[model samples]
Target chain A: SQKTINPNYSNRGMTLEEDINESNLYYLTNGIAVIHKKPTPVQIVSVDYPKRSAAVIKEAYFKQQSTTDYNGVYRGKYIDFEAKETKNKTSFPLQNFHEHQIEHMKAVVKQGGICFVLLRFTNSDEVFLLEAKHLFPYWDESIKGGRKSIPKKIIETIGYHVPIHLHPRIDYLKVIDHLYFNQ
Target chain B: SQKTINPNYSNRGMTLEEDINESNLYYLTNGIAVIHKKPTPVQIVSVDYPKRSAAVIKEAYFKQQSTTDYNGVYRGKYIDFEAKETKNKTSFPLQNFHEHQIEHMKAVVKQGGICFVLLRFTNSDEVFLLEAKHLFPYWDESIKGGRKSIPKKIIETIGYHVPIHLHPRIDYLKVIDHLYFNQ
Candidate 1:
């Protein structure tokens, strides 16, 4: 029997979370990068052992981490980044980022690692790779009553748009190339 | 009243975990490294909302992670490692490691990041920094019916013993310098 292809798959049916996960898998399968979403840290207060199969955690609490998600290595350079998506079309809000994450990116940059943000605008179906250096101004200005959002024109000027691909789906390395390698 | 001082304050009172945590904190505070123990990951199945401000997780399960305990950047180098403490003085058992963690370390190394294990023997209060490259052969041998343990003598020869100090208790970076940087 001929299988009916789901129409949603043809479009960007996947959420930003799913797309980034697919992108990481793509990187892994191609041996291009070794990035992973750091699991949400939790403090376990109690656990239950059931027949030695696997210990089950019975009581836990979410922990506040000092860093952002997705950090690893690429081409002998440390790669540390975070991904966030918003449905708004006008601008990306600075409030989406936390202070500690900004400090972490600064630390990574000071250590000479590649640091950036993967911003996805679902409304326009655009994905941008924004360098941490460009992000610093908006972060600094927001503290002094400047607009809490980064205008689309600013992102379009400074960020590289990641093209969608059939095989890898979210082929972010191509954008990384244009932004970092000038390819 | 002035606090009574014990002469043994620097001799011994802290646990192995405390020493390592203190060392990690020192590294982080000094901006030397960003490594941290990943708090246990858990899946919350139910939660009790006691008040508007408190949401307590009532039921949860431990989630198996596909990576190691500590990972971050150190001096422009991506650092991924694990720490284990054992009371046995004769040897450090191979069973202390998980298969997934070994695989994760291999991936980290392939991506040009430093991967290693920090083994502390609580009985002798000695901590050794063992590079992943040296550990791999023993892991392979264990699978081929060899002794499932890394003997103290072998560890002494191949691993650099981390010296504990008052400020930075675990000071594994000093050992890393001796092993990796040849300093």
Candidate 2:
């Protein structure tokens, strides 16, 4: 089987996460921001401490993250968000998000921290930034057995389309500056 | 040997970490702030997916944290800090901190985020809130074969004393209010 890499984002030969990480490094080195992806949460059940070697965890289990994946300070404001890439072209399924994550987003909003979701439609090679405030009502309706996903068109209209760039890859912060800071 | 609980802070039956955690929870539930302790980072080596149960990690190792233990949003300001407790009544060892963590704090401060350290002298039953900027020179000097620790009196002079409280436990935010916002 052969795979064709989309020339748009594939120029760097990176996944969405790698692109974001590289962009974050760029941000960090340039004194632009201090955002970081939190490490995967794990539950250690057993460990062995040897005499000469480092301690090894013999048994552990993955734990569902209680909060959004990425968080940090940017321009004197607290920033937090979750990023997900979907192959679905028509709509981005609500199932891509977890319940507790929504709750966490609500809390972050209440604290006046910036919160949002980054939706990458891989099939279309496009990305969008949707603020958590705009996303809440749809999530509420979703729990009441409404539309299981937000149509791509609606996302295009309501969300800020994040244009991919060479140096920073996805310029989500540019979208953020336009939306939150009136820049 | 029976552990004696000090009436001052031990009345709540919590260590410095637990006290901070309970306080964070208090702040979160009351809509005051949103802070979280980052999960301990682990390097996963192998895993097994048994069809019947949750995936189990067979081999892993604990990794040194690259940043501070705690961070979040408070009063719309980005908040980040490291907390440590010491039984040494005369001095707090600089060895308790890592180089990368200090660099991370420096970057955070440059971004205008509020960064500090919570120093709990367990034997003396005192806690102090020391800004990251104040601690940096000491760290730099220590690296150049200067004093290996910060004297307790110097800490008391430069750091704001955090009075223990029943409701919020540490009342660090109060110190932040005074120091950062001139509350």
Candidate 3:
């Protein structure tokens, strides 16, 4: 018997979320890393318990988060980061990060944890791992009448380019190993 | 004019969640540690934007998490744990923990992360920090037709009693420092 798959499903593009999830799953399965994206926070206003099964939330609102999207343990060290995708061709906008996230990253860095941002250039299909130390200067400079966005050339120079791999999709730990772990 | 305050609000007891949050905040502000409760995972089914200040989630369901409730960086090490309070005085039931959470703790342990559970006995007004290594054997025993609950006597012997404090409320990290970090 021949099974026919939906063409529309096959034609769907993989979002950054899906790609990272797949990569995290790969890392988890291989015992390489234990990073996971935090679930989207929601404020539940009301709930309805319809008979058996489970209770259904009748009303809710998406809540603002005070930290980054992803965090976990990597090689006995705390690894924390946020991932953002930009369609802009020239530079990556700083507006993608919230003030609380910046403060959170600063705290993580102060605690001697690895803190970074995974920036994806959608136009070029390139991903770069930018450290929080590098990101903070741009964030601080923006308030000091500096450029609100980081130029691509600067990112290309300072940021480590994450190689895309078949199993992990984004072999980010490879970059982390090379840059931080002296591998 | 004197402002009237509700006595009921003042008399209300603080939950375990509030206690932990307050403790984490104290830890953060004092530069002692960086720990946070992961936001409750919610599955958003529908959303509506009625030209408002914020988008409202019309329909959603609370999702079960595979990981523990709280995790963060402490002394350059990954700290992961779940906090649970029980009314039962004799023992802590294994049913409080899901299989996936057990698996998550196991993974964190394997990754050299400090993993534990903060068990609070509501009736006794006592809290204990039980390490994952201590927890795993009991969980494994349950599968082999053993007791489904960890005896309070056993927990009292194996787990370190977390001292309650005024500002932080539940200072479990102090126990962690003593037990794991040798401080």
lDDT of 3 by residue, B58-165 (tens): 777778987999999998899999988899999999889999999999999989899999988887677788999999999999978999999999998898877776
Please list all clashing residue pairs in model 3, or write none if there are none.
Answer: none
Q: Residue A124, candidate 3: how far off, in angstroms?
A: 0.5
- What are the clash counts of all predictions, listed in order? 0, 0, 0
DockQ of 3: 0.65
* Every candidate's TM-score, chain A alone: 0.87, 0.92, 0.91
Across A75-150, the per-residue lDDT of candidate 1 in tens digits comes to: 6668888888888998999888999999989888887778999888877677788999899899999978988999
Lowest-sum lDDT 10-residue window in model 3 chain B? B1-10
Binned by DockQ into CAPRI classes (incorrect, acceptable, medium, high), candidate 3 is: medium
Q: Local distance difference test, per candidate?
A: 0.79, 0.88, 0.85
Which candidate leads in DockQ? Answer: 2
Q: A108, model 3: CA deviation in Å? A: 0.4
The 10 consecutive residues of candidate 1 chain A with the worst lDDT sum are A1-10
Model 3 off-target regions past 4 Å?
A1-12, A51-53, B1-12, B51-53
